[model samples]
Target chain A: MYSSLIITNNIHSWVLSLMPAAVTGITEMMMIAMIYLTVFAVLGLFLVLMERKVAAWFQLRIGPNRVGFFGMFQTIADALKLLSKELTGTDKADKFLYNLAPYFLIISSLMALAVFPFSENLQAFDINIGIFFLIAISSIGVIGVLLGGWSSNNKFALIGAMRSGVQTISYELSVGLSLLTMILLTGSLQLSEIIEVQKSGWLIVQGHIPAVIAFMIYMISGTAETNRAPFDMVEAESELGAGFHTEYSGMKFAYFFLAEFINMFIIAAIGTTVFFGGWLSPFGITESIPWLGVFWFLLKAFALVFLMMWFRWTFPRLRVDQLLTLEWKYLLPINLFNIVLMAIIVWLNFTIQF
Target chain B: MSYFSDIYHGIQTLLTGMGVTGKYFLNSRKGAITQQYPDNRDTLKMFERFRGEVVMPHDENNEHSCTGCQKCEIACPNGSIEIIWDRQVDPETGKKKKMIDKHIYHFGMCTQCGLCVDACPSDAIKWAPNFENAVYDRSQLTRVLNKPGSKVRAGVE
Candidate 1:
């Protein structure tokens, strides 16, 4: 299965052409790690800057335009500043776990980034059970939050970590079920295969009402999973005062911040791949330009990202009880019913295919 | 039924809230109410009645309208005004007259109450709208309203 998918242009093939099989394999692994690391750092900086700009526009303010042309270099400058700051830690805290927590969160997020098919032959890791891999890896991020909070020896951090644990555990259900509903439409867990299935029409279009409902549930749950605003009870500044990573400072603190934006990107990327066609041009107008698939993929992902940003700015944060109520009382039940409705539609052959 | 309606209304309210922000985002360029202060200095305009600082106007001849009445000095609540009047022989009149030696304004201590401006019998001082009053040295804030060698204009008191 993996052999046929290894095309000519990727790093694996390029490295194999240059060296003997044993040497090439090792070198390819190193090269891929370097590439993904660079992507992680670059994406973290870009998404932070994008979030700030979107937030400013929504609030009727011009945000961070002084650092560079339209503040393009602002997050870069911030990352540099964070690098130069002193790394502070709580004196009595569990130093080992505290140090390990940030790495755990960031690594899990970066691992999840592997399965997203950005364009044809562009994915870093195209595992067989791609969506399942993403779902499993994303859940691991909350454990990092838990460790960071509990090990900090601070009540606020502990409370935040506990909230995060509860939120992610509950929301993960809806996130999985919603994708499960779409899986019925595509009938494949492989992301590349999912895109191939959408050759005729996107899942959202083919599956129609049920897919839309699933997408909505997925977005709300995905946002909660990412620990972002409106669903951001974990880091609710009014209550927790910087939350689970509050005791962290400098580059260590930056790891948590960077992981957040990366998680957000992953959420948007999954939404793009599953609902909208991963890299399929709308109406195949740009079918001649295969490279343009990356442009369309990113365009759809960022549109969903912007929608989340819109949600962040527009809505007030939900109370802890309300947050749980929303997930348990509303989202989970609707999600279960939506899955049944989708299964029935698939059974009856009622999906609208163009 | 209420549960279904709750979900319906909840989504409707969320969409309505999004509409408000989306509208502003679309018109953000013109709708942003923030004023970029230093950047817009050239285009910034202050209202006519804005009381920023007390200023004594001197004509091109270096002559002022203050008749050394000492009314403003008496009216100032904070002792921000000091009038040093001395009996001088007026060049034209050749008679001993009360003339201002120094009109010291301790702008650092001024409350901008406009009382000094109001109490000026000859309307000698008025508010200037130049609000940028920062100074590195404390002495820079204490200003002499009358320029060196500036004399009272020859006019009816």
Candidate 2:
């Protein structure tokens, strides 16, 4: 009876010891969130400026140099102007949902950042099913787009929402399938576990031919899923006059804009996590430095984002029919065959080293 | 066999298309070709017949040749011209003469049509190349051509 009492006391002390660590962790998480928000705001500003610069370069004109030095603060000035502008609601619209949609969109996209593993130990939540959680949460953002479109009561907006819904849902399957192949090979759903598997080498390098093929499929489908050009029929400026958020104005519109950029960052971050090995050093030399994973992860993600931007500015918008055909006919068949080929190759140990 | 050849043909066509872009990519770096407008204003080359804002030239004697004629105000299609008349006793003749009190021209509304300059019988007005007319206040944009003590040019007076 005395020995049992002593054991309970020890257990109590252990629990007491863990409390400080838990409190520290909570504080750390709060700090990280604040950082992420700050970074996201800054990134949005950078993207707006970069987009203007890129568009100007493409059109053979200089853009937005008068606001601040080299137009760096132009977006900030524009943001201030937009913030002060009155958000006018249309007369004939579903007032509640129209008001609510942008918030939902921004929230859904922001939630996606929770599961994304920046490095081995640097994740917000190391959920066992992190990959699935990310995919699921990111997909919820589409609901916001659809609601925004439908509630606006405008025909163009409704059509845009429909197009976005169809495109995003359809392309999500290909993105999932490509990711599924990676998950199958790694035999893990946890993002950190996936990175651990790729410690010896990146999945893109280790899995060889199939990995490259899967990567390509993921990129193509991911681009479509993000509603980027040339798959951006939903927001086709020429056809649908600002598209799904056509009736949205002021800060409500800003929320949608923020959501889009955040979504882009989320996809890029997930891609870095899944394929390139989140926080895993290339040569295993940087493993000692825990912070290096964050560096590498961001580098890879930004590279992917740059590629996406390049694709956006370079490619012309695809026709709706052409886009669907590309997905259903070409990408579907190619991905299916690639998956089968990957299965066979993995089973046979037929490695094609790049 | 024909299908395989078609694939090759498609690849060739794609490369050919990319070749055009590749050439332009190399050329874009050589010269930006973009006119940085505000920065390069000093070197901006406007044609001599560019037809900018109208200016009423002032003479050294603080005299203006304008006889308070309202022809230019009538000729203006947009009603952009406004001429205010001030009666003054002539120092030499000791007779009351109609003088243009103040030509308050709002260049913001001016189309640079040169109609006002053309209608001036005294030939005191000409087009000025001072195009840096952007102002923070809309009210301040309405400019008085003749200074308080200045006079119109001697050529027509």
Candidate 3:
């Protein structure tokens, strides 16, 4: 089934064949990086606009509509505003780590984007341990948050960073455990392999209750991991005034902002790929139209993203103690039991595998 | 058993909260409370008594009912209204008939208090609710109520 729809691989080889083998690798790498960066920039603007629009709709207000048609270019105008803004830093701030923080965040998210098997052939790099690589790389962004907050010399920034660090570290465990439960069903760590297994049926449908439970856990922790609302103590702007990136201004702030949206896209993309079946049309409805895979993938991802936005507007921000207790008391214990339950189910070959 | 029920109850409450927002998200057309100001400017109507600004009402003949009493001028808390009165001999009565030469309304300073409207004895001044009062210059904000060469309406002395 997967063999016929491998056009990107062929195009890649054909391009490589035209150039010398030595420079081909470098050229191809540069080409991939350029394309990914372009996608990342456009996607960042779009996600921000979508978030604001969703937020407005929930509050019964019209969001941006003054810029381009339906405020399509509002984010672009915002990007321009950020570009021309003056960079400001605290007088007593450490400059080196402060600057490097944004890069650490952006680079990690970018690296994770490379591993996702969008339409099988559309993947930039198909690593064997794709899920492991994703989990590992995605965690690096929190260090950036930590560094940015601590180096700023602002008390609020430090507190926000520490809160973010704790939230992310704890939530990551739930995210990983939930993913591991799915991994048991799929019998592989590679994202493509995971999606391929879903051809019979999506993992959520195959494993029934456990898969659904894992999915719920994944979504919650993923929200926390991204430091989005309800779990957005990291940048509780109302409380801490811009959180870890409090002192950052101009393009430095934009970098942090854009990286946040990109991280959100990454989490949604992963959720779509793992539980929802990346690039795989529902019930294999559009199976014949190979290019429609991208559409399917984006549709599922955007739906999940919208769900996150809904969560943001509906739930009030939890207190610090409540946030910690919610994780340690509820999600962690549930996830642990869920993993054990999944192990038993898998051992008994109880999954509805096709 | 209570712990399991508690989790179930928690999930139920969360879903209920989501349902409220989801209804709004889906029924946005029915739920939208925003009045798109610029697009609906032509259709937008203000309340008759909104008190956006004070204006001296003039009839089709460009004749007004102002007796130049300076009552509105005296009543204005912000001193936003100025009545420039000119005395002239009436064609019929041949007595000094006090007429308003100009009813200057400085909108920039006016707080839309409706005091001037309330104080007008001849019912000359009233509230106009056309709230889009923005202009490029401060001079444009100070408006003359009477049309040029217009006189007081008959039988309202």
Candidate 4:
């Protein structure tokens, strides 16, 4: 199944041929990682700006429009301000873990970004276990929250960090379960293979009810995993005054901040690839232009991103007990039942045939 | 028995809240409730009855209605208004006249309470609708209400 989807079987060999033997296989992977880290950082800035503008619109207010035309440079200005800030820490803070926290978050999300097959030939390191890798690596971000909160030596930060840890663990079940439901349809855990499985039709439209249920569960759990609003008790600014990252300042704080938007992008990107057919043009409409796959892929992902933002602005933050109840009593059970229902549907041969 | 129904209601209410916000977001053509303050300054008009600051209106002849009675100065709670006056003999009537030298208005101290406007005996001072009162220097905020070279309106006294 994976053999035919290997886009760079020759390309990898070609790179090895051209490069000096001293430069090992890790060198090629490192090069890919370095190039994409810069790309994702730039992409992170735009996502932050887009989230702010969406939040403003939902509240019937004009958001930042001063820095540049429609506040286009607002995030750029914010990045500059964060850069110039002095890095501050408490006198009693565990300085090592305190500083290491933000890097843990940023590196994990950046790793996930590399696995995204944006188009047929677009992805880097199309790992065999892409979905499994994404689920496993993305969960590591919560450690940063826990460490940042604990190391700050602040009570609220510790409470926030604990809540974040608990929330991520519980919701991780639902996110994995939801994706598993879709993985049932695709068979292969490889992302490109999953996208290929949707060649007949997008999963949401083809599988209908069970697929929609899975997508809905995926979105809610994804929102929780990213620690967005409503589920954002981790950094609930109103109560905790920015939670775990409260004591961080300067470009260090900016790392924690940018990683958040990047996490949101990763969730949206996975949502797009799994349910909306990755880079496969919808209904094969724009199939002629292969590169348009990237456009279609981003368009779908951003739409889901917009939906997540809508959930943020419209809903009130959930209380801790209520948040836990939402996961344990609601999403987890529903996701479990949804997986079984989907398997039954697949066995019954009732899914829409293209 | 009611457990499933409770979940349904919760989902329903959540969707309703989203619908209201979704309506506003889609109707963004109506624009946000926030007036882009700096951008819309030219077209942004205050209400006709809006009172911002007190000003003594003057005609092209540089004549105003203040009799230098200091009524407005007395009415000001914060002492934001001061009337500068001197006694000058009225040549025509052969009587001493209390003519205004200047009416110093410290906009920095003003609360826009309208007491000064209400207390002016000659109707010389009234509220100006314009309210953009920002200034770089504190001294620049103390304005001369009586324009330079302006005298009292001929028969206002």
Candidate 5:
């Protein structure tokens, strides 16, 4: 059955080759979608182990070191445990929404994986509106959070859901604005096209002062969107307990947990695509060393993940009011100013040869 | 002032922050702040004054200095001590005497307060450094100090 699908897809690609650019684009997009689902399932396993190890290092303790060599297979064991355990739902919960929330969360975040370019020709989709699709798909995760909280019929869960809703929506503006500056500079929303623009230099270096400011804004906003530490008031143990998924048990809880780590990877992957030049090597170095682009891409993504972990361990959770105020007062204004500065730089083509 | 001065000031602040982190990172490799309990058992050391389980010292002749005076039994606040006596006819004195047949001590109830050791007039008992007293069965914790055939000495009392 799968072999038939692959043959059909290849045939479709060949047929579209004769059409104009528009039909070929649709065929490429379908191939990208198929690859995205397969890669992300494998990536989720690695991410779970990485998050646990990172958490352990920050707290000065050893975590999950018994299953396999250096505890590599610990996540697999945990998944087995979750699978065998009975999933129990609370009597008070909205059963349908409670069960549906995890599926929504996982599907939406996984959808964002479509636009991430792993290498020069490795993108799942080369949509001209890739950034817009990414931002739109990413916000759908908040719907799952809200549903999970509200359906659980738990006060803490509801509060957590509400906090996540407010936090994600607020941070989205700054993240969108920051990416807008990049979109303006590249004059394209397609991730592959953005990489083409960065063939000579990464945006962080080439876009200069405004690019640096935009990168900072993007990092902070992305961290908030993932509900990472300092901004992780939603799942704050002392305050909202386990937050929106408080009533979920066994495999259902595991689904929510898995979605969180996947969300982290998605944020880091998108950030890499935008500011660090996706799969493009700096100064056109990949021409001599073709694999250098993938190496550079992974290096940047992992560094961003490490920074997120560092922020979680280092800072205290912000008070609800403080978090909102920082978003509105500080992040929004700085991002707006950054956009104006970027427009000036692009207009002057300051360092670019027209 | 100038853009170059602003850049220099930023670098100075960054270096100051990095310096503090560098000092602590270098110091951490010397030794961990907490001790590993099971791994370092041989070199495990505690304060000299730490009180552990009580032990009765026996001489080369297998004779303990306890007179069976029942002082420890009385001194124990928790009733953790028991003394059983056997009447024996002394060879030298030609009289029946009460000899300590068994000295049973229930360590499960022992708090290691050192009161019983201080209360004993003969100074036969002292604290032993065997703090790993955990056992599978609670009954095994009630120890019998005096062996089955052992008896108190003659005349020393």
Candidate 6:
């Protein structure tokens, strides 16, 4: 149904008409990079502002209303302030790794952002192994945290890095397994194909209770993966000061901050893609208006992001031991059992659809 | 079984916490716990007994009840109150009486203890709830409680 509205293809052909093949390819890559960079910056600012506003509501206080109408420009102003700040670091720190750490995080998150099929023909990269690439790229951010912490030459930073390593390593299994559970029903790793399968109904509906269970597991692990609150061991300010990025300053610190929100968006976007039908309109209500798929996609993703933010505000930071216990003891076992149960259901051909 | 129960209870409590926060979040405008201080200045009311500052009330006639008693001066723990007195003849009685030349109140030194107000025999002073006491100059804080060209109220001992 969405085949006729192919905008990205048209743009590619238009560019190709004017330039040689290699030059056109290089130009397209540059344009895509610029687009992703802008999206990353805008999403980071918006999410941070949303977080502050959501936090205020939970605490029953008016938050960040003085800068712009409803504090719209608060993060923008904050970004400007961070830009002007001095890039300070420890005198005896490992300068190479410390400088390189934030790029690992930013680049990985930006790379993951490419595979998301925002709408039909709107995706920058449509890799056949899209979900696999996302899962792989997502894990690379932990290296950034590790390098940032280890190279800072501070004990707390190192401890935080270690905690992050342990946390990410364990929780990554849960994220992968949970998504793998859904992969059984969709039977394709390509994000577009997964959404295409969901044209009959969202995976959460078709896969029934097992999908719901997997979604819960995915969300819990996803929050930990992002190093957000309740799983914020990596930046436990009370214990580890500012954690892995403690020594980072100026735009260096901003890079880490922006990468965090972008990572959060990626997590939410993946959940939307796998379970909520990516950019597909609900029951094909707005399927004809293919451009509106971006709207549906963002709406679902932002809803999930809000849910994550709610988890952050409502829940207390998990004690380091409790964090592991919950992941290993509860999420992993349930995830394994759920995966088998899903296999049985799919085998029986008992999947429900609208 | 207890392990399962713990998980159940944990999820229950977590949901309960989220519910509370969610309820507040939805009605945040109504349930806001903080006041916009500068914005709500007109409606911001201090309690009647709120000891914001010390003031000697004067009538429309610009007459005060100080009577140059020096009781407040003695009672002040911080020595914030200073009363300069002069001997004057009562116009009607032709009797020598003590009258205040200047009721100097060093707000900078006053601790809002209300001791001076308590010690005023004629009930000349009381707390004024105008707490916005900031001033650029230190000298500006040392206020003369009694206005210039003002007289003591009649029928005081």
Judged by TM-score relative to the true structure, which candidate is superior, 3 or 4?
4
Clashes of each: 0, 4, 0, 0, 0, 0
- For residues A247-305, could you state the per-residue lDDT of candidate 2 as single tens digits? 98888998888778777777788788888887777777787877787899888988887
Residue A42 local lDDT, model 1: 95
Query: Taking the tens digit of each residue's C-alpha lDDT, what string does model 1 give over A1-354?
Result: 122244534656777788898997667667777888897799899999999988988888988888979889999999999999999999999999999999999999998987878887677678889999999999999999999999999999999999999999999999999999999999999999999999889999999999999999999999999999999989999999999999999999999999999999999999999999989999999999787888999999999999999999999999889999999999999999999999999999998887
lDDT (tens digit, per residue) of candidate 2 on B53-88: 877766567776666677778877787778887777
Q: What residue runs in model 2 are displaced by over 4 Å at the alpha carbon?
A: A1-35, A58-69, A351-354, B1-30, B45-157
Candidates, DockQ: 0.65, 0.14, 0.54, 0.58, 0.15, 0.65
Distance from true location, Cα of A255 in model 1, Å: 1.3
Local distance difference test, each candidate? 0.92, 0.77, 0.88, 0.89, 0.79, 0.92
Cα lDDT tens digits for candidate 4, A107-187: 999989888888877887688899999999999999999999999899988988999999999999999999999888888
Candidates 1 and 3: which is better by TM-score? 1
In candidate 3 the C-alpha lDDT for residue A217 amounts to 91
In terms of docking quality, model 1 is medium
Per-residue lDDT over A1-354 for candidate 5, one digit per residue giving the tens place of the 0 to 100 score:
122245556766586678876777676556657666666665677778887776665555565667899899988888889889988878888989999999999889888876677766555556889898988998999999999999989999999999999999999998899999888788999888887887767777778898888887888889899898779988999888889888888888877887787888877887888888787665655677655666788888887887677666656688989888778977798789888988898888874421
User: lDDT per residue, candidate 6, A217-332, as tens digits?
Assistant: 99999999999998998999899889998889999999999999999999999999999999988879987888898999999999999999999998989888999999999999
Candidate 3: give the clashing pairs: none
| lDDT of model 1 at position B137 | 97
TM-score of each: 0.85, 0.71, 0.82, 0.84, 0.75, 0.87
Give candidate 3's TM-score: 0.82
TM-score of 5: 0.75
Least well predicted 10-residue stretch by lDDT in candidate 5 chain B: B24-33
lDDT of 2: 0.77
Q: How accurate is candidate 4 locally (lDDT)?
A: 0.89
